[model samples]
Target: MPGPPTIFVARQPIFDRRAAVHGYELLFRGSAENRFTGGDVESASAINIEQSTAAFGLDALVGERLAFVNLSRGALLQEFYRMLPSERTVIELLESVHGDAEVLEACRELKRRGYRLALDDFTDAPHSQPLLAYADIVKVDLRQTPEALTPGFTSRLRGKRLSLVAEKVETPQEHRRAMAAGYDLFQGYYFCQPEMIETRDLAPSQLSQMRFLAEVSRSEVSFEQLEELFRRDVAMTLRLLRYLNSAAFGWRHEIRSVGHALMLMGVRPLRKWAMMMGFLRLAGDKPHELAITALTRARFAEQLGPPAGLEHHDSELFLTGILSTAEAMLGRSLRDVLTALAVPDMVRTALLDGGSRLGAVLRIVMAYERGDWPTVESVRTECAVDERALTDAYVSSLQWAETSAAA
Candidate 1:
């Protein structure tokens, strides 16, 4: 039996300060090896739907989280309902699924099992009309649908008592238009902006020293352990303080102790700078494409769910992503760095295996850098970080780097 080839889904919550997120629409993302096309359910059926649903169960659907997943006609015919607990998962009968009696009956039977149903990008269908009563939410894709006819279509569907969600609201203006049109839920980039920016290298040796500094920042090593790291690393310690105390950070007093400095700078912030340094550390001092993913993933992970694992006292996720491609950075296998720094097991799992969930997320970041839209998804189910927060991080990194240069 073949296993599910790792289809990660990241949800975008539709909420505001005025209202809590009532629901999240499940979006599918593929791995580095696979690209999930927006359409083509036939191609999707070639993978194991049962195992794929299990991965989704692991990544999402734990709590009261409600997600919308597109169901191909093939999945329904195969009795895929056994794979997911109907109570936790909602089946969005796809628009592409031809509205035959058997297909509609399958949807109706699934709904009878207490599953929430959605009509995917579909508002009206004579054959699927029976399934409409089962729909709890209606997704209105403002991006693809004609703007002029939206009001009329939305009005026609208003009486269904289903919540109208404006999917793919890409700008503030788009959000405003949707909200004004009485959209109960919203998704997209109105509140956040992605920077059209690029990163440059400072120098190679300086980068290595910064990584050494990052090791110090997130390290849980005792004072003696830290001092031991400093034995042959004196110059790195001095440069770290210089960068930390510079005018941009605006340290009013000269911070003298490493521990005190660590407390003030914070591990995430330090790791971010160290990532920039890591990119510059070798390969003739040119900004490489691979470094871009590491930086983006580190920046994105810092904004996500709680940081619990601190292998060797560092934020585990940051190292998981920042040092994911360590072999390339140092011109050796990750095994070399792992052996040298005494990194923890979890970090090892993420860097070398690419099998752990964190490893999966790291791959998403790489896909994102390469503009592989299908691969950059959240298999974590709930998203603590979305496009908005990431866009903000990118813009902020630029401003912070500029300030660092000035100081």
Candidate 2:
């Protein structure tokens, strides 16, 4: 028999009106073709449904929130969704699934069994009525629906005891429009894009963190220098001591001073933790997912370095990944954000121009995050990395980020 098929999976956050993650839409493709072809969708969906409900489990993808799984007509009729938990799974029907009698009855049965149904890329087509009547959620594709018609289109879907989700919202303006249009949930990269308004100067604490990051980014920074930086910032000092004493570190003795903590963690490990803390500090009051994404990308890129022939520059690769979202957190352009801090030439080039090998690694990490498998495949080949290695790195990074963020 053939070995188990490769499953490429990525998740996009679904946010509530308050910008909190409500769930995630799991995006997956059976192969690198990037689009559903032949029996790929059905076969992949079946394997995922089984794995998500058992074995690996949904906790690997989403801790405890709902999982929105796409279902083609064949999967719906064949009851592949039955393998998933009704209360925690949202069966999202593809647009190609018509409201024929068979599908309508299948959706009705799903509702009676307590599974919430969602209509994907909804545009009020003639064949939508049968399935629409049973849907608990309707996703409006903002890219296709147009801003001028958003409110009117969403208004008709409201007050029917169903939530309206704004899909493909890519900017702050689109996010605001979706909110004004009464979309209860949002899905896209709006939160990851910088708000295009008057950029505020970095706060004193933020500035201090950036300076600390700059100092630590160097491979030769003295521990005393790092400790002095921590000593100047009372909050950083307290955070460092507290982190070392925290249960995650399992220290039998309390770590009372910044110097002792820095020495104990050593140079390389200290650099990693300190940089991550700095990123979290820069994240400030943004949604928690931003920090998580930064951590995930950082780890993912760091792991890719060895495979991509940049083994000696893992630290810079990690820096490149973490700073990838600086613009989103700082509310400034990427160039402005990078200018405020010091980074190596490779990192700067990767962030600014994507013209280096480090840039290629960053691109692969990003494409993998968005489930843009075609780009991922091309970039992976361009970087000369094994596909399985990339998949393992991403999966491990996701788990690591969750634990790291929680700690």
Best prediction by TM-score: 2
Residue 383 deviation, candidate 1, in Å?
63
Worst 10 residues of 2 by lDDT: 194-203
For model 2, how does the per-residue alpha-carbon lDDT over 1-407 read when each residue is reduced to its tens digit? 65333445556789998889898786654455434455545445554554343323465567678889988775676465754567788989988889999899888888997899999998767898778789999988888776423566776788677899888888888888788878899987775421111111112266566556545644356677677777776756654554455332345686656778888756544544443445534654443477578778988998999989999997788788878977877678999878766578899999999988999999999999999999999999999999999989999998877555433
List the lowest-lDDT window of 10 residues for candidate 1. 193-202
TM-scores for the candidates: 0.40, 0.45
Write down the RMSD of all candidates, one decimal each.
21.0, 19.0
Report clashes for each candidate as comma-separated counts. Answer: 6, 0
Instruction: Estimate the overall C-alpha local distance difference test score of candidate 1.
Output: 0.52
Q: Which stretches of candidate 1 lie over 4 Å from their true place?
A: 1-7, 16-19, 33-35, 38-53, 59-64, 123-131, 147-151, 191-407
- lDDT (tens digit, per residue) of candidate 1 on 48-156: 2322332223233324655455676755643443334455566666767766777777767776767777776654656656666667777767756775135777776
